[model samples]
Target: MTVIENIVGRVTVLRGGRYSVEVDVITSSGFGRFAAPVDENPDLYIAEAHRAVSEVDEIIGPELIGFDATEQELIDSYLWEIDGTEDFSHIGANTALAVSVATAKAAASEKNLPLYTYLGGTFTTELPVPILEFASDSEFDYYVMVRDLMEITDVVDAVNGVLSNLKEATVEGYSEATEKASSELGLDVALGLAQKAPMDMEKLLTLVEDNNVAYLKPMGDEELFLELIAGTHGVFIDGEYLFRQKDILDRRYYNALSIKPINLGTLTDLYNLINDAKSERIVPILAEARFESSDEALAHMAVGFRCPAVVLRKDSIAKLNELIRIAEDLGERGRVITFEG
Candidate 1:
């Protein structure tokens, strides 16, 4: 007999004669192949996972442990606990995912049928699974660094080196820029300079200064928290100024970014989507979502998203010159603006 751990101890039956249980376990090993071996390790990840499950268990687990797992309302209540909160990293996301799978399995078991039957009676054996080929200059790792980067020079040198290397790796199969001059001439370049590691502002300053680059400013922590709730979009490659747009939903692949004042409707929608995404544990590195404001007046509010961070500016471009000016003026009190918005 399997001696289930105390956390997974009991199940409760609710409506439709279904049952569910809240389970928490300290796994003997970390989950991710990429993140497990980092020098920092998965200490934070595991700790956060444990914390998240524990929080879910403390609330909904006790209430529904002995109740029918198929109680849709009960399940919903469990989901609602973290619905609007952006802090899904440590909540019951993994557990919720497992439970969703379990619910399907249990329903299948009771019906003496396969899991997909609930979706539709027909079962198509094969689905188109995505094959993401991220070719890189070096084998990229997601281990987050705890180091502080403060100088503009360091930022520029590091960003330039990283971008150059990545460009060499990924520029081979690009079909879009095959006719462009530098690209047509076969000069390797980072596609969009998208980075997956920790971003240090000091490093960003350096990159902006060295390259003479202009960029959207990052919303500070306070503004971020607020816009996260209101669902405004805000993000920055190397902060030189703030960017605002009407709506995040309008943002799609390669859509030319427009500088404009974001209105209330778009801001609210952005907030809801981001919160929902966070709750579902679907943090997309290359997507934008809305956030809310933390204060009454949202003058500091903004929008956010992800981009492939290539330094797309050439030395002679006017945009490049503006970026240089801003980078040189770092630490000085002056308003930064770009694109008339």
Candidate 2:
């Protein structure tokens, strides 16, 4: 029956001394554990983790005991009811997400199915193309260096050389870097800008045109988003600037949406948002938060949901390695996802 028997949560320390919550969901037939990361003030992250643990021990665990772990949607909805907040403020979003995902993992284990197969059925084989970031001396020179090195040697050595010799350059330089990398690497590579502050419209447009920028995460107003969309040929306006306002997707201002589990509260909520984004013809990108845990469940979710792309940090090796394994397991059935801007 896979009836829930007990639930436990504990504080887990992550890289750079960050704190997160690891949840263990025990059922009649199987068990699952998941660590959902929380990005907070370093001074208060420990307290937040403790609070999430306390919520599981004192509130969520007791309420969810005896429920069927396989009924993922019902259990996830109950998490929201228990929190009694639109934003999961009472129990914390990290706690809700950890419990929701852990329950799914337990059910999948009981059925002896891989997590992606359990969540997405047997036909889920497409893998999202990874957008890797590097800390280089210049924004675009690494692209040129990597391309040239790949021509002389292999990709690994090229990346290694770039990492060993770090330098900085202005974004305005290397206007043709994206085209060169795409041609040389035999894969489409585009520039992604994480715009934190407003810039002059003319200047932003010039940068996009000069650099062949394809993805933009703009922090400006709706006018700026509209300007970029109209001004560029095929630029993808990322919806991450909207943050928690998933409802704003209805406006169709952005061509791509970022899905982060912790921000959305529960697995069902995350799933629903992905579907919603797709309904609007928006490219759904499973993204990593600024401060992430070591959990690889996100990689599974990206595969399960058939996200076209994933915005992952270069140093997030756990997720990267998992994606590699999933690709190998799928063998001939797996292919990298392709989509237009």
Return the TM-score for each candidate structure. Answer: 0.32, 0.88
**Best candidate, lDDT:** 2
lDDT for position 201 in model 1: 47
Instruction: In model 1, state the lDDT of residue 143.
Output: 12
Lowest lDDT block of 10, candidate 2: 144-153
lDDT of 1 at 197: 40
Task: Give residue 340's error in model 1 in angstroms.
Answer: 36
Q: Candidate 1 at 208: error in angstroms? A: 24
Relative to the true structure, candidate 2 reaches a TM of 0.88
Error of 1 at 158 (Å): 33
